[model samples]
Target: MTQAFDIIIVGAGMVGAALATGLGQQGIRVGLIDKAVPADFDAHASPDIRVSALSAGSERYLQSLGAWPALVAMRATPYRRLAVWDETPHPLSRLLPGSLTEVEFNAAQLGADHLGHIVENSVTQNALWQTAQAQPDVTLMTGQGLTSLEQSPDCARVTLEDGTELSAQLIVGADGAMSQVRTLAGIGVTRDQYQQQAMVISVRYLGPPEDITWQGFFPSGPRAFLPLHGAGDQHPDETWGSLVWYDSPARLAELKALSDAQLMAEIGKSFPDRLPHLTHIDAKASFPIARQHAKHYFLNRVVLAGDAAHTINPLAGQGVNLGFQDAQCLQGLLKEARRSGDDLANPRWLGQYEQQRRPANRRMMLAMDLFYHLFSNQIPPVHLARNLGLGAARALPFARNRVARYAMGLDEQLPGPVQQILHRLPGLNRI
Candidate 1:
C-alpha cells in the first residue's frame, strides 16, 4: 500500500509527535511513523529510569499543542527550585564556605509559579501521542520502521520494512541520536564521546515529593537528583526520585554489578548530604555521554530535528528542550512555506531553519563542554576558578538571574555577554 502527505515524519517520539500535532493542527497533512508505539502509562508502575527536566518554554510549547494538561494528568512533577554546587574538595576550598560555592534558583525569586517539571520520557511520549492522534489531519503509522529512503528533486519517499510506501513533499528525521534516516540520507555527524558515563538510578526516598532538583559536581563527574512523584499507598511515607552518577565506564560497571543494597549504601556515602534518605532502588542503567552534530540539517528533500540533528551533553537535561525548540522552529517555518505555496523541502525555508537553529544548538553544546572540562579536573587554579565563579554568580544577583532566566527558558536569547563568551571559546565554532 502507498500513502502520501504533505510531510512524513519518521520516529514518533516526543519531538516527532510534537511536530506531527503542531503541523496537523495547522491543517497540514502529516504522516507520523515509528517502529513501535510507546507503552501506555501505568500509574502503579515504578517511575521510568529516563526523565526530562522540562523548562518553562517547553511547557508553553506543549500548552500550545494541548498536551500539557494530558501530561500533567498522567503525572508530571513540578520542581520550583534548582541547585548546583562544587563537590570537589581541596585545601583552598577551606577558604570558601558551602553557602558561597552553592548556587540555587527558586521560582519565588523569579516570580514564576514553578521552575519546571520532571517528566518521565514515556509519559511525555504517551501524552504527545494522544494529542497527535487526535489531530484530524495527522495519520499515525506505528510498528512500521523505515527501511529505505529515496529523494527526488520534486519530493521524498520512504519504504517501510513491511513493504508499505509513503511519500511526501519533505521528510523529517527525528529518530534520535542514532538516526537511521540520517544515515540513509548520507548525512554524517561529528561525534566526541566523553570519558564519563551516566548511570541513572530510580529510587524511592522517605519524604514527600520535593520541589527542588540538584546536582553536585565532582572531579569524576556530577551526582544529581531529580524529584519524581509519590510512592503511592504501597509506601505511604516514601516518594520516588531519580539519582544520576556520572563516572568512568569501569567505575559505573563495578557499581552496576553490586547488589541493590550495596549500591544504595554506596549512594548514601558518595552523594551529597542534601540527598534525601533513599528507601528503595527500583532501577539502574548507564550509557556513555557524547556531543554529536549532524554535518547538515538538510539535504535535498530531507531534513532533521531533535537528537537526529544534534545531541549535546545531558549534564543540564537540555537535550529534549533543544529538541522541542527544533520542532517549534521547523513547524513555524513549514507553516510559512505552506502559506507561500512553496515546496515543503524548498532550500529557502530549510536554509532559514538551519541558520536559526544551528548556532543556538552549537552554543549549548559549547556551554556543556565548558562545564564538563572545567569541573572534571583537579588543577589547583582551575578548581579555585570554578568555585570562585560560583561565588561570583551568587554575589551578582542580576547577572545570575539573567542566566537563570535563559536556562529556565523564560528568556529567548541569552544575555549578550554570555553568548559572546560562548562564541569566543576555542574550537567551539567548528561544532
Candidate 2:
C-alpha cells in the first residue's frame, strides 16, 4: 500500500511524539511511527531512570503545543533550587566554597519561578502520545520499523519493514540515537562514549517531596538527585522521588550486584551532603553513556528531530530539552513556510533547519564533552580550578545569571521571556 501525508515522523519517542503533537495542532496531517512502545516494565517503567531538566524555553514550546499541562498533570517535579559542587566536596557545606558559591547555574538569579521540571521520560512521551490521540490529523503506527527511504528533488518515498510505503513532502527521522530513518536518509553520526555510567534509582525519601534539584561532580562523572511529585495526598502511603548517580561502568556493575539493603547504604554514601536522603524501594539500573550527533539535521525531503538528530551526554540532563528545541524550530519554520506559499519540501528550507540547529547542538555537545573530560580527572589542580571557577561564577551575579539562562535552555531556545532574560547577561555577550 502506498499512502502519503503532509508529514511523516519515523520515531514516536518524546521528540518525535512532540513534533507530531505540535504539527497536528497546526492542522498538519502527520504520520508518526515507532518501532515499539514501552512494554510496561514496572522495573523499568521509565526507560533509563534519568529524568530531563527541561529548560523553561523548551517548556514554553511544549506549552504552546499544548503538551505542558498534560506533563504537569501527570507526575512531573518542579525545581526551584539548583546546587552543584565537586564530588570530593562534602554535601554538608550547604555552601559553595564561599556562601552560595557553586557551579555555573543558579535558579534564583535566573529570574524565573523555577529553573524547570524533572520529568520521567515515560510520562513525557506518554502525555505526548495521549495528545496525539486527540488530534484527528495525526496517524500513529507502532511495532513497525523503517526499511528504506528514496528521495528526489520534489518528494520522498519511505518504505516500512512491513513493505508499506509512504510518500510525503517531508519524512522526519525522530527514531533515536540509533535511528534507522537517519541511516535510511544516509546521514552519519560523529560519536563519543563517556567512560562513566549512570545508576538511576527511584526511592522513597523520609522528608516531604522537596522542590530542589542538585548534583555533585565526581571523577567518574556527576550524580544528580531530582525530586519527583508524590503519588498524591489521598494515597499517603506511596512514596516519591528519584536520584541518578553517575559513576564508572565497572563501579556501577559492582553496585548493581549488591542486595537492595546494600545498595541503599551505598547510595547514602555516594551522594554529596546537599542532597536529601531517600530509601531505595526499587532496584537500581545502570546506563552506559555516550554522545551522538547527526551529521545533518535535514537532507532533501528528510529531516531529523530529538534523539534521532542529536543525543547529548545526560550529565546535565539536556538530551530531551535539546530535542524539544529541534521540534519547535522545525514546526515554526515549516508553519511559516506553508503560510508564505513556499514549498515545504524545499531543500532551502530544510537547509535552514540544519544550519540553525546543527551549530547550536554541536556547541552543546562540545560543552558536555569538555565538562566530562575536565572534571572526570583526579588531577588536584584541575579540581581546585574547577571549584574556584564555580565559586567565582557564583560571586559574579551577572555571570551566574548568564549561566542560569543557558542551563534553562532559555537562551538558546525560545523568543520571549527566556530571550529577554538572556539579553541582560553581559557574560553571554561574547558567545
User: Please, what are the lDDT tens digits per residue for candidate 2 over residues 1-431?
Assistant: 78988899988888999899888988888999888865432432433365677778778877887778887876677788776555544443344444223454446776768878888787788778888868999999888887788887777888888899988889988888888888887888877776677888877676677777777677667888778766445435544677787877788889888888988788778777666656545646777677777777887788999888887778777788888888888998888878877878777778888888887776666555444433344544333334435333333333333443444464653323323333342222322
lDDT of each: 0.86, 0.71
lDDT of 1 at 206: 99
- Highest lDDT: which candidate? 1
lDDT of 2: 0.71
Clashing pairs in 2: 91-273, 91-274
> CA shift at 220, candidate 2, in angstroms?
2.4
Query: TM-scores, in order shown?
Result: 0.94, 0.83
lDDT (Cα, tens digit) per residue for candidate 1, span 276-340 = 99999999999888889999999998899999999988988899999999999999999999999
lDDT of 1 at 287: 80
Model 2: residue 214 alpha-carbon error in angstroms: 0.5
